[model samples]
Structure formats: C-alpha cells, structure tokens
Target: LGLALDKPLVAVETLAALAYNLYDTEGLVCPIMDARRRQVYTGIYRFAGHRLETVSGQEAIGMDELLGKLEGLDGPVTFLGDGVPIFRRQIEETFCQPFSFAPPHLGRQRAGAVGALGMQYYKEGKIQTAAEHRPEYLRVSQAERERAERERRAQEGQG
Candidate 1:
C-alpha cells in the first residue's frame, strides 16, 4: 500500500528487525532468531554516520561460532530477538564483554518500525517499484519442522 502511493520501501533485511527498535545506541545490534539444532539466524549491524551498516553476513550458525565473532567485537552490544531467551545464560557466561538485551517493549518487530524505516529510505532516494517489491521472508514454520522430525523418526525405526 505504501509503495502504490509512491513511497520508498526499505528492505527489512537491509535494516533488520532489531535495527528498527534500537534508537539511541551506537554499538552493534545483533539480532538472532532461533533456527533450532543449536543454530540461530543472525545478523550483525551498527549505525555508521546516517546509515546503519552491516558488520557481518547474516547466517544460521551455532552458538559457539556466533560467540567467536562477537568475541572480536568491543564496546556495548544490544542482543535481541526470540533466540535470546533460549540461550540467555550461555550468552551471559560465554561473552567476556559487556552486553545487554533490549527491553521488553523493543524486543520484537512492529508495523510502526517498518513505516519509520520506509520514510527514511524515501528521504534517502531509495525508492522501489511495486513490481520490484518482494517479501523477504525466510525460515520454515514449526509445524513443518515437526512433520519432518516425525518422518525422520519413522525412517530410523524402519531401518
């Protein structure tokens, strides 16, 4: 709807879900979503001048691997997303640097955030056509995962 009206559409993957919630912070914004099997879908980002910059390629990685990347970083880091609660204690203990989780209100994605990012893109002359727009959804649903697990178990039993 916003695009039909001739507005710039900022790709959510460009800014990330957590980037929209972080306002005052100037440190790295690491958003991690649980991807199961001790792996997470994560992206590292930080604001450089007027724009948010990606510090690392987003990937589904194990906790130890993610910690290794974070170990190289200094200063404060804001950790958020559904993955945090799952591995909070491990993150606190394994991370040698100072870190904090976003507050409850700013922990998740919201519609207002998408709109705000869209406006910023408009001002920056980052407009896109409706035809060019495509949803950037990734990850399989829990139901699908469960079904796959059941199939795998049945196959194992047959063997």
Candidate 2:
C-alpha cells in the first residue's frame, strides 16, 4: 500500500522481529541477534499477560558484552543470524552451558516472519513512520574501521 499510495514504506528491524518471535512463541526473554564482526543488534523483551512487551529496543552491542548479559539471565541463551557463523567458535569457547543453533531454515532471515511480527507490533501501537525505520547494522564493518584507523595513524605520523 505504501508503494501504491506513494507513501514512505517502513520496515521493522530483523533482529527485533526475531526477538519478538522468541518472546511470543518460545516464552523466552531477551533474544539477541549477532550482526557480525563481534557486534550485535539486541533488545530486552518479555511476555506480559496476553501480549508481548518490549522492555528495550534496538541496541549496538559487543559480543563479549552480550554474552555477559546472557550470563546474567537465568535461562538458556540461543543465537541465530548470519553473523552467528562469524563468531561460532568464539561463542562456543566462551560459554559454559550447551548452546543451541537454529537449522538452515530458521537461522536465516525470512520475510514471512517479519511481516507477521510487524503486524502484531502494528496492532500494539508500535508502528512508526518510514523515516523512523532503519536496518540495525549494529556497528561499522571491520574493513571500514581498520581503514579509518590506518588513516588516523598516517595523519598522526605526518603531524
């Protein structure tokens, strides 16, 4: 409708949608999404009565910091997203409990789940203008960060 109406199209964050599903379907709390390069797009959520309530929204987090947050929680922590592959080894080494990985089908992002979750959020007064929506990349890529660091060092040497 946004396209036909010539209105701005708003999209919810993928990580947020995943978090919502964990809360709604699995009765889990504080689902997190790895956004690669040791960073994550995370949120704190819980099921309240008949509906899900978002205690926190999108946030940029470091892998170690996220693990610490999970350690503080009482239940099993699960991870899903393309970024998981990047940090799988490190995660397994760092955590003490048995970690779970979603299968190929459920691990990747899916539009169907996103749309359904978005609808639920829309009805709960969570909808926003397209201008307010943005993909949660969490952090600058490692290449970009390294390039900036190199430039900084070059300038430092010249001056």
At residue 121, what lDDT does model 2 achieve? 68
Question: TM-scores for all candidates?
Answer: 0.73, 0.64
Candidate 2 residue-wise lDDT, 31-68, digit = tens:
45656556767765556664655655668888787777
lDDT of 1 at 9: 54
The local distance difference test score of model 1 is 0.77
Q: Which RMSD values do the candidates have, in order?
A: 4.5, 4.1
- Give the top-scoring candidate (lDDT): 1
Model 1 residue 9 CA deviation in Å: 4.0
Cα displacement (Å) at residue 27, model 1: 1.4
Q: Give the poorly placed runs of model 2, Cα more than 4 Å off.
A: 1-10, 20-36, 44-56, 130-137, 140-159
